[model samples]
Target: MKVDLFTLVLIVFALGVCVTLVDVGTLFSTAEATVTDETEITSARE
Candidate 1:
């Protein structure tokens, strides 16, 4: 079986998009956790 250049590019592009989305999701989750921790620390100090 032979693959065409356009098909190959499309597959690569899709994979990259999927990876980026996953990374963004991870960043959001981490940011949320960090914010929550900071809030708790601040409130506790008061």
Candidate 2:
């Protein structure tokens, strides 16, 4: 078994990036849903 520090760091960095991207995607979807709900409410009121 031979592993270097750089390889470990690169693996960790890639995981972190994936997690961040997923988080961003979730936030955007939530925001979009909220906006859609608000629009529906407004339409109902009118």
Candidate 3:
């Protein structure tokens, strides 16, 4: 099997986009969890 330069570039770009999207998603979920946890803690303290 053989891949040309253009094909390789496309594959790399696709992988980069996927990784970036995953990172953003993970950051959002983590932030949401932290906020929820803080709210629960505050409510409990009240």
In the order shown, the candidates' Cα RMSDs to the true structure are: 0.4, 0.6, 1.2
The full ranking of all candidates by TM-score, starting with the best, is: 1, 2, 3
The 10 consecutive residues of candidate 1 with the worst lDDT sum are: 1-10
Model 2 Cα RMSD, 1 decimal? 0.6
lDDT of 3 by residue, 1-46 (tens): 8999999999999999999999999999999999999999999999
As for candidate 3, its clashing pairs are none
Runs of candidate 3 with Cα error greater than 4 angstroms are none
Supply the global lDDT for candidate 2: 0.99
Tens-place lDDT digits, model 2, residues 14-45: 99999999999999999999999999999999
Which of the two candidates, 1 or 2, achieves a greater lDDT against the reference?
A: 1
Tens digits of per-residue lDDT for model 1, 1-46: 9999999999999999999999999999999999999999999999
RMSD of 1: 0.4
What TM-score does structure 2 among the candidates reach? 0.93
How many residue pairs collide in each prediction?
Answer: 0, 0, 0
lDDT of 1: 1.00
- Provide the TM-score for each candidate, comma-separated: 0.96, 0.93, 0.82
Best by TM-score: 1
At residue 12, what lDDT does model 2 achieve? Answer: 99
For model 1, the stretches where C-alpha displacement exceeds 4 angstroms are none
